[model samples]
Target: MQRTPEPELMDAPEQASAYAAADFSAGDQALIERIQALFPSGLGPRVLDLGCGPGNISFRLARADSAAEVIGLDGAPAMLQLAQQSLEKEPALAKRLSFVCLCLPSLALPKGCSGLVSNSLLHHLHDPLVLWQAIAQAAAPGARVYVKDLRRPPSPEVAEQLRQRYLADAPAVLQHDYLASLHAAFTAAEVEQQLHRCGLDQLQVAEVDDRYLEIWGQLP
Candidate 1:
């Protein structure tokens, strides 16, 4: 299927709120487990979660390690608002977890992050290379990288089927965004090509389960 890019940022208030309210714990936990399995040495001293939408993964990262600092960076203020609110409630994580409101393709992204990870952030970019370049520039020399996103299905029918199978009972806003994200997602092969183009061919891209792609490896 041809890629159809969605709005890069889910900055709208309702959109952010609905997304924050949705229950993605199952998949979120799986992603975290996958990251841990791939890099058993553990994420380095500093971890950056790109497109951290409400900081679900960010919180997990912080809690998984007492010493590691986790930064959740997203372009949407609305999402970050909720993340900050959640952060405020967790006094223990107040110092280890921080949320930053910054869009991609900017020099402002932290330099030399020991670990870089993102989830479902790939499909939203109008220019996919923005993600690859950002990862390359932001990562430390031997950073561990693990990125997971929905893979574009073969057709609209398949995309809808996946949505209905997994998200039939989700909120209407979430369902709509889910379908759009499926269409906007890239295939495993495409992501492999993207890594090659970014001079990051060391990373491996693989299609996962029914509708996801994963990229993982240590940077050079």
Candidate 2:
């Protein structure tokens, strides 16, 4: 499937709410586990979660390391609002985790981060280089980076097939978004080219699952 760009931010309340309500436990948990493995111990004392919609992975990162402070950055105010509400529910997490409303490629990071992670965010970008540039700017020396996103299927028929197989039970809105995302997603080879173009060839890009691709490694 050729790349089709979606909105860069999930700023609409209805869209954000539907996405927040969607059940992504299996994949989310798998991503958390992989990130944990990257550090073995933890992601150091500070972490940055780019495009952290509703703070799912940010909270997990905080929990993975009791001492780590996590900053969840997103361009969507509605999504950040949901994340803040979630933070309020977990008083302990509130201290170690916080959400910031910031768009990517700005290069004005909240702080020099020790680690960075992003989930399902790359496909939304109109220009892939924005993400790579942000990553290079935000990361500290030797910061661990992990990014996971849907891999564009070989054809639209395959995308629809995967959607029916995996998200058949989801709400119509969620299902629509999933299909759009799949169409917008990059193939593993495309991601490799993006990484190389961004001068981040050291990062490893691999197809981690039938529908997902992962890029992970440390900053040079």
Candidate 3:
């Protein structure tokens, strides 16, 4: 299926609310576990969570390592608001975790990041290269990189089947966004090409499970 790009940011009040309300603990926890397993040594002392919608993984990343400082960046203020609200409830994470309102292709991207992880941000970008370049601009020597996002199915029918199988009971807005994201997602081959263009040969891209692709490695 040809990729149909969705809006880059989930900034709408209703849309952000639905995402905040959803119980995605299982998938979020799985991602944290994957990161820990892949980089068992640690994510270094500082980490950046790109496109951190509501601080879901950001909180976990900060909690996973007491010494690690985590920064969650998102383009959407609505989502950031939710993240801030959640942050207020956890005073312990106040000093270690914080959210920033920022988007890709920006010169203000924090430089020399020890680690960078993004979840579901690639598919939304109009130019996929923006992400790869951002990774290069922000990462320090030997920075760890991990990115995971939905993978476009071979056909729209398959996309719908996966959506129904996993998100059948989700809210209408969530369902709409999920399907749109799937349609906008890139395949593993396309991601490999993007990496090649960015000279990011060190990072490895592979299909994970039924409908997702993950890229991970230590930056050279």
Candidate 4:
């Protein structure tokens, strides 16, 4: 039997470009609700949102628990600036949130961070292990890391349906984002394989929507 070739994932700039118009606020909100449920009160976890564009997810996480200090890190300065501006509009988030511009491949994280979260950022890397290594160094002992990624190898029919359903309703940029994300997404099996190869298979992972996946692990 023959198999289909997987669509290629987008590189960094393309991924960022797609998100230039993507509605991260709504998506992040929904995702944060689930994340919030998984944690106990007192907001003990200091959080980091890798590839945090415009600080949408960072702001939401900070707002979810005022006591929790949240940092939004991205490679793009423009995105970080936008995040800064966005937060400026919300005085409540002033003290609790901050943004940093840094390249992920050379990221230097402070020791003993409580938690790390990356949303839709894994597929942009050629070496996912680079990310895993960084995640390991940044997290405190038993620190929780949650990553939300898109699942790839979507059936032709399903991909088309997504185009017609979600893409069509989105703006031109968001339409592009949806398409790029589809191309960049990895299959659940593929993600599992990659995680195992990266020595992160022990993490508890879950599949959400047909095209959405999440992984949560602790640094030993």
Candidate 5:
């Protein structure tokens, strides 16, 4: 499937609400586990989450380490609003978790972040080099970076099959978004080329699941 760019931000109120309400616990937990495994001991004190959506991964990261502070950055205000509301429910995590409204490739992040992670953000980018360049410039030396995103299937028929197989029971909005995302996503080889072009060749790009590709490694 040829890549088709979706809107850069999911800023609509209804869209954000539907996204936040969607149940992604299984995939989110898997991403959290992968991030934890990246560091044998634990994540560093400061972490950055790009395209954080409603803070699912950000909250998980903070919960995994009491000492860690997570900054969740997203381009969507509605999504950030939802994230902020969730923070009220967890007063303990409130102090450790923060959300910023900023679009990627034109990011302004605090320096020296020891860890960075992004989930399902790549396919939304029309030029993925923006993400790779931002990661290189923002990450601290030897920062652990873990990014996971959907992989484009060989054909639209395959994409539809995967969607029916995995997301058949999901909400209509969620199913629509998943199908659009799959069409927009990049193949593993394409992502590897993007990494190489951005001097991020050290990162390991691999297909970790039937529908996802993960890129992880320490920044040079």
Candidate 6:
């Protein structure tokens, strides 16, 4: 597939709106379910959700495993605030999940985290190697990492498939997400190459769909 143009960083307002407008359709939800099935219960893992706008993935992780300690990190303050608001209504989940405002490329992680999960964030990175380094440094040895993101070109056929099969009734937020994700995604093969270039050879990256790729592996 042909590569799409690299995405430019959205400013604060745009970032906030984009996040607000973000929605995970059935396909995205299925991907998350697959991620959830990977973890065993009662392990009480420490998980990090990078670029966790509105804490969607963070909240989902907490819901998937109440015993896990989930931390959400995002660069935009507004997005963080929205996450906080959502947390307000789910006190049980709110206690287990926390949000931090920091760019993934430079943020420090608490030691001994068991896992790391990021969705729709890698494409926004100007230097993914920096963030990958952070993921490597933060996770404990043998810790697991799962990332779901777009693969480029979002062929007209695939877009139409997504629309007809899953997005026909999608909300505006999701529609925007679908389009933006296309522009922001890269091919699975390309992402795998990048992981090796970043010295993340331990990572295993694979494509899950025409628009979605899952990159994961246990840290060395």
Residue-pair clash count for candidate 5: 0
By summed lDDT, which 10 consecutive residues of candidate 1 come out lowest? 19-28
lDDT of each: 0.92, 0.88, 0.95, 0.71, 0.88, 0.72
Stretches off by above 4 angstroms in model 6 are 1-29, 41-44, 154-177
Ranked by lDDT from best down, the candidates are: 3, 1, 2, 5, 6, 4
lDDT string, candidate 1, 1-220, tens digits: 7898899999899998898888889988888888989998898999999999999999999998898999999999999999999998999999889999999899999888999999999999999999999999899989999899999999999999999998899989889999999999999888888888999999988988999899999997
Residue ranges of candidate 1 with Cα displaced over 4 Å: none
TM-score of 1: 0.98
Query: How much lDDT does candidate 1 score?
Result: 0.92
Candidate 3 per-residue lDDT over residues 1-220, each given as its tens digit? 9999999999999999999999999999999999999999989988999999999999999999999999999999999999999999999999999999998899999888999999999999999999999989999999999999999999999999999999999999999999999999999999999999999988999998999999999987
Error of 2 at 142 (Å): 0.7
**Model 5 lDDT per residue over 88-135, tens place:** 989988888999988876747656888889898999988899888878
Clashing pairs in 3: none
Off by over 4 Å in 3: none
Q: Write the per-residue lDDT of candidate 2 for residues 43-140, one digit (tens) a residue.
A: 67789999999988888888878888999999999999999999999998888899989887785786678898999899999998888888888888
Single out the weakest 10-residue window by summed lDDT for candidate 2.
Answer: 103-112
Question: What is the Å distance of residue 148 in model 5 from its true position?
Answer: 0.5
What is the per-residue lDDT of model 4 for residues 149-219, given as tens digits with 9 covering 90 to 100?
A: 87664465676677777668666656665665666666677777777777777777778876688887666
- Residue 178, model 6: Cα distance from true site in angstroms: 3.4
RMSD of each: 0.8, 1.1, 0.7, 3.6, 1.1, 3.2
For all predicted structures, in order, the TM-scores are 0.98, 0.96, 0.99, 0.84, 0.96, 0.80
